[model samples]
Target chain A: MSRPLLVILLSIAGAGSIVLALVVGTYPISVLQVIETIVAPAPGVVHDVVWQLRAPRVLAAFACGGLLALAGALLQVLLRNALADPYVLGVSGGAALGALVAMLLGAGDTGVSFLALAGALGSIVVVFGLTFRGGDWNVYRLLLTGVVLSAGLSACVSLILVLAPQAQVKGMLFWLMGDLAYAGSPVYAWLILAVLTALAVAQGIRLDLLAAGELKALSLGVAVTPLKLAVFFGAALATAAAVTLGGAIGFVGLMAAHAVRLLGVSHHRALLPLAVLLGGSLITLADTAARTAWAPQQLPVGVLIALVGVPAMLWLLGRRN
Target chain B: MPGVLSCRHLRLQVPGRMLCGDVSVTFEPGQMWAILGRNGCGKTTLVHALAGLDRAAGAAVELDGVVLANTPRRRRARDVGVLLQQEETEFWGSVLDYVLLGRFPHADSWTGFSREDETRATQALETVELAPLSARRYVSLSGGERQRARIAQLLAQDPRAFLLDEPLQHLDLQHQARVLARFQQLVRDERRLVAMVLHDALWPGRYCTHALLIYDGGALASGASREVLTRANLERLYAAPLAEVSYDGGSYFVPHV
Candidate 1:
């Protein structure tokens, strides 16, 4: 596909998904009704359903999806590994553990978000402390540390599930599987996504040089140490924001970045934006499908994300081969 | 004064061995220096040290009489360029894009390269006879073509000094000669310094004005081609070998097998 065509298609996909999510729900708002609510507001069932409930939820999902995909693309270049994802560094694992604990204590959604945010930040600090030593960023060491930390944290999560009473298990599982049922506000997520994406895109050339190798980048006049520090912390913060908002949504980061690359967008400038668009659109559509798939008995959006992203990626890869 | 790269009382060592010891050398413009040594003699290590990509313990390399370690990386890169023997990282861009990265030190903006940068990169590709493969994916190129592409990238860098490690690794005989002659022309015409690690003793005598012969056990010999690059020094450098073959007022070393 030509670059412009891909851009147009992705933009249409994003806008179309948002419109579809706004129009399709339990209240059965028509497309015309959705347009009317946007153009002229009234205090009624349509306004309550469209503006009060679904709109914020849809926006949150979009912001979270963009954040995760951006983080994934950054981590892949930072580690020079194709398999790197937002959760690969134990940020989501920590958030999951924190969320499960909050649910077990019977705290409300706000408390869970707060604790999850704390846990995610804590994970970032720990990994940053361990991997950065002697003024050097050890890329492989960071990977190993994150993988091990994730394994340990997940073990703790499993223990919590086993020890908790039967009643709380389902809720805990839903949170672990990523429930955006009570995503507090899209405002913070949007802020983070916007700032970080702009920063990453601005450094696109340096990022491209970095993917070649640290020494190679330095030889070409890049300040490797500072750039690595920026990328590491930026990716960790983005992952933290998304995990806190969406309860550890998986595969959006990995799938979106790889999908963009597989579509032949090699440069970071084009790749980052396209990944963000594809990811945001994907999660919005997945959330819509998850809620309406069973009508009043919704599946976790995280599960649907994997379900949708995995097959699409496989199809993309298969077509390439 | 601002164009010389030199080291004073430098030493390099691995865990159990010393690569080089107490070696001091100065490289001036308009001369191509050949770093010739057998495998494991630390030619790569020395090039890396001179480029300031790696440190030589307690010793600092000076470029224009300023410590390289203290200089800002971008300024150092503007002055010096290095090509490693091998790179483990994978690049997914086109050959032209790869070469354009050589102009990075000259770039100031966060946006794309300027038209001048693109023109220089294209000219570099043409210099290496790779203009036809400019748009080809870098990874898809054959080994020799990739080697040529890297050479083009170094040329595009347009640094004051070039430090190349085994630059002729995978090239055919024709490419080897062509690449050597290009570097020679850069030294002669553009007055750019060129230092390359080479395996063939014959090419240095024919093409180089200066040579550094590194022997095992921390021994070092360096001077003009006549003084430091003799048949005896070549024998000592390799610990095996040689017959001196003269052709058209130039000397060449052949390994006696």
Candidate 2:
């Protein structure tokens, strides 16, 4: 199929999945009722559920997924490693630590989100400081430093989990498992997602050169230091925003990029957009299943993603081999 | 548009050893120079230094009397292009897409590649004889084909000066000849400065106008190819005896048994 047609089809599939998510919740709202509620609304239980609750949740899911996938794609190219993702660089761990600490201090949702963003940025600074030397950025050294720091952050998270009061344990677990129930206005998330997607797509050519290698990109006229900084910050900010809204959702950030590559969308110009669509669809679908699968007893979205994404990615890898 | 690339008071050193020290040389347009040295003799390091990809204390590389250190990376790229010995193989994309990356320094917008960029990339592929494989995945190509594809990418760059490290590696005799002939034609027709690290002494003697031989202990000998590429210089550079033979009015140096 042509690239444009494939992109259109993916977009349609993503929109359809979101619509299905809005209509198929436990309230038994039909698609027609959902459409009516969207187009012409009256203040009712269905209206409140569709517009105030489900719509924002679904939108948050889509934005968070898109952010994660775009971050993953950029990091993969920047690090020249197929396995790189937002979490690989310890961004999510740092964000989670910050959010949990805020919750422990009895801060509100907004405070938690701000702290999370700060922590994510902090991790990026620490990683760069440790790895970058004399204008030389070694990928292997960066990878090692990030992995070690992630492990350190993971230990800190475990220490916090063990020390938290019993009353907050369930909430903390839910957050760590990437629950979207506490997400604020989706407008902020959606706007950030749109802006970031634009910036990343604008640098699509630079990303292509980067994937070849840092030296190759530099020789090709890419300002390697500035481009690396841009990608590092771009991926970090996207992950921070996603974690703030959806609490460190996994799988989408790591798997969505590889999944798109498996489908033969290799170039960044196509990869970035397609990964966003597919990633948004994946998380929206996962969040919907998380809410409705057991109905009345909602599971964490991350649980559903891992349960599904691991096997799917494994299958893709097996087929490729 | 003819210009000169000159390095003054250049020095490069790793932790324990000096690669090159206080080396001064000038490369002019309409000349193809070969940097000849034994393995691990800092030929690659010198190329990187001259290309401004590596910065050493007290080293100064200038182009047409303009300091290279002060030139913006993008502007310098338009005038000088470098090809490393190692090429990235993990990138997944069509050869055409890969080659079009060379047009990045000239692109006006980020939306897409322009028509002129595509035309240049296609022409570069034709020059490298890889036009038929333009649609093939870069990772799927053979070693020689990959080398040619990279050469095509550099060709698409169309810089005034080129610093290539081991451009002939992985190439068969036919490709080596064809690519060298193209390089020779480029230098002759357009007066571009082409400096490359080479292992084969015969190629420099037959095709190159100048040679730079890296001697032991961070010294350099550079001049007209015929003057600097003698059997005595080859023996001193490699610390091994060499036999010189005259073929077609050119001298070829071979390691003596």
RMSD of each: 1.8, 2.2
Top lDDT model: 1
Candidate 1 residue lDDT tens string, B1-257: 34798989878666688887777999999989999988988888888888888844334689888898787887888899999788767788789989998888888747578999999999999998999999887888999999899999989989999999999999999999999999999899888899999999888998999999888888888999989888889998888879989899878889887
Taken over the whole model, the C-alpha lDDT of each candidate is: 0.89, 0.87
Clashing pairs in 2: none
Global fold similarity of model 2 (TM-score)? 0.94
- Considering summed lDDT, which 10 consecutive residues are worst modelled in model 1 chain A? A312-321
TM-score of each: 0.96, 0.94
| Best-performing candidate as measured by DockQ | 1
State the lDDT of candidate 1 residue by residue for A120-209, as single tens digits.
988888888888898997789999999999999999999999999999998888878877886889898999899999999999999998
Model 2, A267: alpha-carbon shift in Å? Answer: 2.1
Chain B alone, candidate 1, TM-score of 0.96
Task: Report the lDDT of model 1 for residue B95.
Answer: 93
Evaluated against the true structure, the overall lDDT of model 1 is 0.89
In model 1, which runs have C-alpha deviations exceeding 4 angstroms?
A39-44, B55-59
Worst 10 residues of 2 chain A by lDDT: A312-321
